[model samples]
Target: MVAIALCAIGCQNLSLPSASTATTPVVIKLSGWGSDPTEQKLLKQVLKDFETQHPGIRVKYEVISDQYMDVIKTRLIGEAAPDVFYLDALEAPFLMSQNVLEPLDAYINSEFDLPDFEETLINSFKYDNHIYGLPKDYSTLTLFYNKQAFATAGLTSPPTTWDELLTYSKQLTVDKNQDGRIDQYGYGVIPELARQAYKIKAFGGQLVDENGYAAFASEAGLQGLQLVVDQYQKDRTSAQKSDVGTNSGSEMFGQSKVAMVIEGNWAIPYLKETFPQLDFATAEVPTINDKKGTMVFTVAYVMNKQSQHKAEAWELISYLTGKEGMEKWTATGFALPTRQSVAQKLGYEQDPVRSAFLAGVEYAMPWQAGKHPAAIMNNFDNQFVSALLGQQPLKQAMQRAQAEANKLIRAME
Candidate 1:
């Protein structure tokens, strides 16, 4: 569920000391996707601050360029894994089951404000009630509407229901040049596993049973996802995930090519910088029927169970994810803080631009986790796309995916 995108890097360029003897740099290695220039700078500064605060330990950061999983898996299998690496909600289950992640429950205990983090996000890292990680940053989904497009369609506020979404989309969509084809799409959705999974829940479907087995062939699941495909294939109001090339949902909405998009807090800065001419506003994601829900994803700094210097690792984890560090990192509005205290202190709960995302937290479900999460996703996405293209009925496509996922999961069991 936590599909980290590449943006907001370079926090600060604080220098870290090499693995040493007196300071006895018990190097704690951290791994994750590449970040934006600014985030990277800020992170480096944070690490340097960690080093200065705990002169007894040293921290190292590593990022994979390509085939990221393969690289991490190779290192892990060879026992060359990072002491602290990033884990997404979608990928956590598999890694945690393999005993790759250290359970943070004992470490977290009463010292940290565990209850202050978003409940939806906190539970994502829990397997069998054993906590494995602490969320460093978190975000929730919201509706981003292009104000000009809304005014052009004679609409004031964005829709709050599925039916209204369809109606507004039809009104906002247009063929500007009018040669023959449509120049602007009314709405769009990224058909990735994470986004589609959000849709599945919104429509009262669960991807897997409570026992952690596949169950996406259910009526609610298929109907939920079919809504997305039908809008594009039949209603002609939404664009295919790939139709916009490399432009993100925010980019498309900002260009006025799409009237509405369900995006997160991270895109606000990009929109302000890349498309300053566009007028936009954020609203809570529309309800499906009468239910209101969204997907929540998070990441945390976790210590390695196998590390000889856990005390040192916890020192960094504690500082970086603590109130002070989280507050500084979220100061630029790059991401929404997971802590309720940080969120309140930053006034994100009151800002209109962030209100919807903040509100979504109360109902947003965590992205699925556990062993076979990636495989489950890979198989579902392929069959889901086939269903979207009409090559197979929604039921059959999902059944096929469900069957395959069950087979894979059973083998592991």
Candidate 2:
């Protein structure tokens, strides 16, 4: 009887038992951070549709508006976490290694068409041959360039290489008045590790050693980072958010403070809505060291191992990440679908603004650095910014960051 029930709930071909037949609907909780209002509305609709399909199950969705990870962690320690929750790729490594997540391999079967998902994304949630979560969607970084700025600068197309990007920056930067205070910079830079990880990898630098120790202070790493420092400090072609009195790269580009910025898919809608008059387009991140690279941000739906309604939780996870659910979720272009079939069906590759982001999926680096990612990321960002600002030598800053991160990782162990 138990085997039959499990199959009826998990196997798509098997008809689910009607609500009338069940004594009570099994209520399962789902939790994730708050997003755009439209995104939230779409999710609620998806959940409603899920309930309709499986009348025997009810979903109680909760939004953790701020400090999502911290709240989730506290709940997990108390065994009060939701049955299903969102886990980002960066945080996936730590949680997957902790043995608190349900290994989803048993629930997944051939009918799920697991092959449809992007390999890189699916692999992020896998540990020791057991799949812990299914990536719901992902985004890749791409160059967002202002078309008017390009035209005024007499440039025909977006930069195809880092060298070209730097050259274009110098040409695009302009000052309308005779004042020394420049009105615009060529590029807007986000000096955080998440944004610069691919740059490090461009020159064959590893973020961490096999033992999970920070290893980004190598010569290869410095070689790539030097490009950023030089562009900011020496050439003065790029401006950070603080420099331009903006909160984000999108804002800087929207205000015409920078002609170009490397940003993720989320910037598309924002730019369109906030700055309706601005004309912009996107291209794949320019190649560095003759290698194509960008960073990918992905989040997955993971199940709590301690959930009472394990089967129902699996049902919700499978449906949300399944092809049908993914299609509806990604139709608005808020996020790029992780499933290849869905992407093809949506025709995102042909989308002028999103095509570049789609093109980058093949070479994009997942924003993860082993189990102790926070230590590595926080330390690197702090030191890398100092280097970018000329407060310290790039080599010295990275070395100090690497040592400090390793020390923290050691303490965690």
* Best-fitting candidate, scored by TM-score: 2
What is the TM-score of each predicted model, taking all chains together? 0.90, 0.94
Once fitted onto the true fold, the runs of candidate 1 whose alpha carbons sit more than 4 angstroms away are 1-25, 244-246
Worst 10 residues of 1 by lDDT: 1-10
RMSD of each: 6.5, 5.8
Q: Residues 116-191, candidate 1, lDDT per residue (tens digit)?
A: 8888887778877888887888878888998888998899999999889989999988999988877788997777
Q: Write the per-residue lDDT of candidate 2 for residues 112-218, one digit (tens) a residue.
A: 99998989899889999999999999999999999999999999999999999999999988886869887899999999999999989999999998988999999
**Alpha-carbon runs more than 4 Å astray in model 2:** 1-21
Looking at model 1, residue 369 earns an lDDT score of 34
- Residue 388's lDDT within candidate 2 is 89
